[model samples]
Target: MSLADSPIRHPDTASRPLMTRRGWWLVGMNILIPGSAQVLAGDRRLGRFGLGATLVLWVVLVAAIVTWFAAPTVIYTIASNSVALWVVALGLVFYGVLWLVLTLDTLRLVRLVRTQPSARVPIAALTVLVLVVASGGAAYGAYLATTASGFLSSVFAAGPSEPPVDGRYNILLLGADTGPDREGTRPDSMTVASIDAETGQAVLIGLPRNLEDIHFPSDSPMAAAYPNGYGTEQGCLVDVCLLNSIYTEVEQVTPELYPDAAARNSTPGIEAMRDAASGVTGLTIQYFVLIDMQGFEALIDALGGVEITVEERLPIGGDENLQNVDGWVEAGTQRMNGYTALWYARSRYSATDYDRMQRQRVLQEAILRQFTPANVLTKFQAVAEAGAETVRTDIPQSMLGYFVDLAGKTRQLPIQSVELTPETGIEPAYPDWDAVHALIQDAIATATAEPTPAESAAG
Candidate 1:
């Protein structure tokens, strides 16, 4: 057969060459349909495969977009599942590499050098752009998914789902303090967030670090050691036991008490605190989120920093007395870095623990508000990495979908708090157990109950 009637396809034969417009159209087809260029003029086998993959991807994309608008929670549920995420990552990898190969083949068919020399540069540049966006973008996405999977695995344990109690999920939040200055890791900041299972309204119940004579659950391992409470008969100045010390005290004194905790990917110290928190609040703590206070600094830094109103001057670094202050975070509304924010939440120099606790709450609220979706999307990797290193929780990773949904709701509701301090008739040295339970219950009831006209108008 003559060249004009040749059965085999070749690159426009060197003699015929290609016009700039012809080459541009070929590249455009590949960019638009991924494999159309090949199917139209090149390899049908490879083109078919690429076309098939592209069709599936387009369908999935359209379905996902529709599902997001129709029922967003379903999307969230799927994204939270580790297995689903892995599948997504793998799919992106396979398709990304495949599309990249197809694009390069499309470029070869275009025969850039055969076109106007001027068009070759622009065409090559455009092809390079597509490769980066299609392949490089996919790689970045896979990295994020893998990062999330690792974070969930490291921070959240795999366990049976913990059901809420009394229409609420009481979560124990602890700021674990560990360093060379401290003997062992201590849950310095203890608060129980009692959340309405449906409404998502939350009531924060703060327990003072110095809370003494804290009674353990009747059946708790620590209960036998001190039947009356977790303290000595004589109290302070003798052999005193404070609430914050319970964690380290248990680990050091009775590490064997919770042997099963390790198997469940939990520590004895956390189990002990969960029991104590339950006993103290008279509410079952279904889950516990333990965050190392040191790592908390990094979390704040990841958000670029946080702004808090300081009504008083707070000392930075100091000793036992906190007298030799290295510097002071001057009074006024200020944006602080990790180190400064940490001190703002912990300064106990000339201030009482009550003041410090209040400051901690202030900082917590400020930081929590900073986690807007846009902000998180920008800084998620840093935040997730920091959390994996510093945060520990008993809540199963399987339940992440539910909790993530719950968190979205909670963010919309106003927060109420009850602090166990002198102002609330709670004495660190000797708190009235009956009164403490009553206050916590009342707080929860108020938080979950619908506000009346008069109560609503009080604003």
Candidate 2:
């Protein structure tokens, strides 16, 4: 047809005023409210579908928030459910795809109204680029959620433990060693971490591994076997009554003592140790997380090692009795790899268990400080894998979200620690339970209180 004399006119090809601005407006509308752009562009059917999908998403999100606040157990149950996680992962994928399609459709509407061909090409390309980035981010988030759900399911048990009487969660942190020379895994390091539910202030009460005359709660199985105190009635040596020996002794002699615990907990020996620790510390141990010492090196390596101040030369490899130091870590503040850090925590060459206990606490604090979010994100996969392998706990997966929130609070609070040692008037051979309890209570009180100028300065 001749240019100006053509009788036929293209209805869809008509040049519209503010075409470029309208195209940009459609992009903005799609970004803010997914379907509104389609509706404004006269695509009622597609717009209705998009609006319905968005409504469903908002409803699900609101329900999750309500459930998290009202009934956290339900959220935990959902998080622990493998099928639920799979369904959520699939739903996220669908949402991502739909979002990408809607973005492209919005750009198409822009093209329909666009008068300049050159402008349309760049606008469409830019719209696709933005949608691709957003969709990619959503997909990555979904992947991380799936990985976390799986890791939680693998490491933590399903059932919940009762909270302590003082409105705090007392978790027993046990470092278990399962060497070939030993009959069974023994708790080499035992500490009760009493955490305030509201403030996240924590008090670490360290129990010396060689503490003798270990008391057992009246209701505990150990008490039933040895009413006078573990190893006291048997007339065995003090080493038989050491606090750390309770785990191996119980596992060897009475593995079936706590049948109920077997339902939610895998290690009955650790449960026995928890009771003994509870008896001595005067604080109920709600849950226990046992870290396999052999796997601990891998976990530290996964976290890219930890930085700590070494006050003495620590030995790495030695005989079964921890004698004849083959390798020594020099005394200094330095970043240690997994093997050196593990030795720094476990070494007992010329040092006693009490000294080792203090070193362990320092190593723990260093790990907490170094395992920052930036470091975690950088090596998430390795950390997740190592953590799953190293730790076995009775803490349910449902409580993880709450614990994560509590951890955020803990980062703002000071950690108070009390170690039962000879310097603190605590005799491992004849530990006074009353004095130990008072020390722990004092630490907890100090941690929960607002810091004074002197306390802040000292800290």
Candidate 3:
């Protein structure tokens, strides 16, 4: 019937006109099984709707839990897609409002004015507590979903996808180090991640920032400028005109190098770096991810920290020599904050850049492996905010779902790395560009090769 016509008077409590014992029982029943009090007493139709909604929600929740167990990658895919997240948020708000309405209606059926004065406070408090527990959880979930959706939209682009070349998708990863003191943007750390399209097998090809005379593709805009190699036309110092300088040299000094770079929603620097990377790796670079190292420390901090073993003591900060040592990281296994980890991955005060390159690779893998499902869910907002500031890429947002799924598969497989260093081969000063490309191609070939039956069993 009507809310005003609630059955406040009970025949069982007729002996006591102002007794609240029956009121407590009905409210408790409503809290335990929403709308149960109405089902047993007043408004059976409303009670049925509440009960049906609860059952459907429980079923959906159970299915989602089961899917998480059976195929977690599916969950990641759904989580990354903005459309899916919006739908989930709407669903949560719908269920939350339904439950809230039922609970409030149940409170109306209690008819607090007819209950004993002494029991009124406790009954009201319990009802409010129940409302908060049931509705607040769903509200929080909806907020989280909306936050993730906005994050995905703001961070990734909507560009069209590029097909893989020769069974592999090569992504250029650049860590651009730029600041007030620095002359221009220079991607200090560069690597090419070549992943198999069908299988998730992958190899990381590390390119030293100091590699000299980096060649560009034949048809590249830069090919005509430095026919022999980079730095030939620039007339810059050996230390200044390294592989990483290609970015700054093009963007600041020679913006006219790539005429259509701006139209492509890219910078002359990034396009130049991509071409140089392709020439070095002998692979068609499909996309590029530029990580702002200055802001990237925040992401590492959000992830708590990274742990690594130090083979020797290294100074935290110094010029090119150890004359001005800021601090020292003692040798051993230790966990470090973002600032310390940055130094650990890049310290070259008393060591070689090759040493730093190796450390950087280890640090990269360690941070990636740190991502577990539990931590990601709990600290999602923090991670997303830090990521927005840390990454700029040409990878399409439409491909985020596919990339998330691919990441899951990649996590399950082994990752191999090939570093071009002094120990490995020719000198960086007078290097053989052809040899470096061959090494990268061989690494990709070995990474994509199918394992024999005997090898598979052994593995």
Candidate 4:
């Protein structure tokens, strides 16, 4: 029969309403199906081709599903079978694209129906292609969600453990800018995070980066190392002795190359600083997290900016020593991104590192306030991803889940921040190990004694 001479059966010609209804019903299904609509519209060739395409699409979909489940072993060649997280993100994108294509195909089919004698083959082929893509995308999206859940479960497996100290735990959170970029390598900022797991009370202690005469846990044989001192005054002397020696030694060793080696270099320099701080604080360091400035900035931005009080008026571009990256910022109760916030917290140009340390303490408090439900809801994924990239710690991967849970529960609590600097106490010319030990002992004792509920509220 000639294509023009072919009979076109209208649904109105059917004797029973059910029979006529079958055509419209088939058309509706065909809108999203491969070739069903074409068959109802009297296109046999299209119906046959559509069925074949449907079968092929289903087969491919099943194969993809199987591959998705086997992702952990396949993608990483790891022994354990695990789903890949990135696969999930890709699946979401695919689903969105597929949905758009399917929607367009439906519109095309509707347009074809407007023709006097619907040419079903063309529309049917298009519908089949759309269905195949959409169905595949949907299947992939489901697979990705499953895989991503598994990946997240693996990511936050670590939890906070009981510190050696009876009830209170000391966490050393260090922000170091000493990675690939070499942006800045000032251990200029440090936080001694003390959490009373029992009482749910927390205290963050900040220390000035340039507090002269602080103790150092040195491996240098030239410096006189004092392990223990007799009294608080003697302890101060020991710390003084150590810092003076470190400054002298760093100056002596390749003076031009190792000018700031006592503080800048990550290996022995940073490590020894940690040890010295630990010795002085008397807080058994339970956990330590070190992050570079890039990661630090990313985290602040992800958290949607932290809230800080304007302690003193800060004008931009005053200090030549800070170089160009810093000193170009005004200070106030301002919302700061990671970079700007870092500058604010690490600004040591105008005043001593002591002033910067106070800023750091205030910023930490600001962070606790900013990391609210509203903040997390708005930027949870961003913050999480940024944190994963920035932070380096000794905490095991397995306990991250516990830490996350702890963080969530205590995120809203008011942060009590304090800075131990020369302004608060005396700085000896030589290392006074005994005095430093006493200071740490008093702080820990005060922190551990469970405060009255009213006292907690007052603080």
Q: Who wins the TM-score comparison?
A: 1
Ranking by TM-score: 1, 3, 2, 4
- Local distance difference test scores for all models: 0.80, 0.78, 0.79, 0.53
**Which candidate number maximizes lDDT?**
1
TM-score to native of every candidate shown: 0.90, 0.78, 0.85, 0.55
Task: Put down candidate 2 lDDT per residue, 1-459, tens digits, no spaces.
Answer: 542332111224455545766777778888777887776674768878888888898899999999877866567556556667778878888878888988988877776444476677677777877798767867876786688678877887778546556779998999988656666678888888888887677788888887887778889987888788777667432246678888876677677887776787566787888899899898888888899887899888998889999998877778667676678899999999888988898887658778999999888777765676558757877878888889988887667656765665666667788899988889888888889888888888777787734568899
By summed lDDT, the worst window of 10 consecutive residues in model 1 runs over 3-12
Please list all clashing residue pairs in model 3, or write none if there are none.
Answer: none
**Alpha-carbon runs more than 4 Å astray in model 2:** 1-33, 51-91, 104-128, 179-183, 235-241, 318-332, 335-337, 369-380, 448-459
* Models sorted by lDDT, best on top: 1, 3, 2, 4
RMSD of 3: 4.1
lDDT of 4: 0.53
Among all windows of ten consecutive residues in candidate 4, which has the lowest summed lDDT? 72-81
The lowest-lDDT stretch of 10 consecutive residues in candidate 3 is 9-18
Clashing residue pairs in candidate 1 are: none
Q: After superposition, how far is residue 60 of candidate 3 from its true place, in Å?
A: 3.5
The residue ranges of model 3 lying beyond 4 angstroms of the native Cα positions read 1-38, 69-73, 110-126, 233-239, 259-265, 449-459
lDDT of 3 by residue, 205-238 (tens): 8899988888889988888788888876665432
The CA root-mean-square deviation of candidate 2, after full C-alpha superposition on the true structure, stands at: 6.0
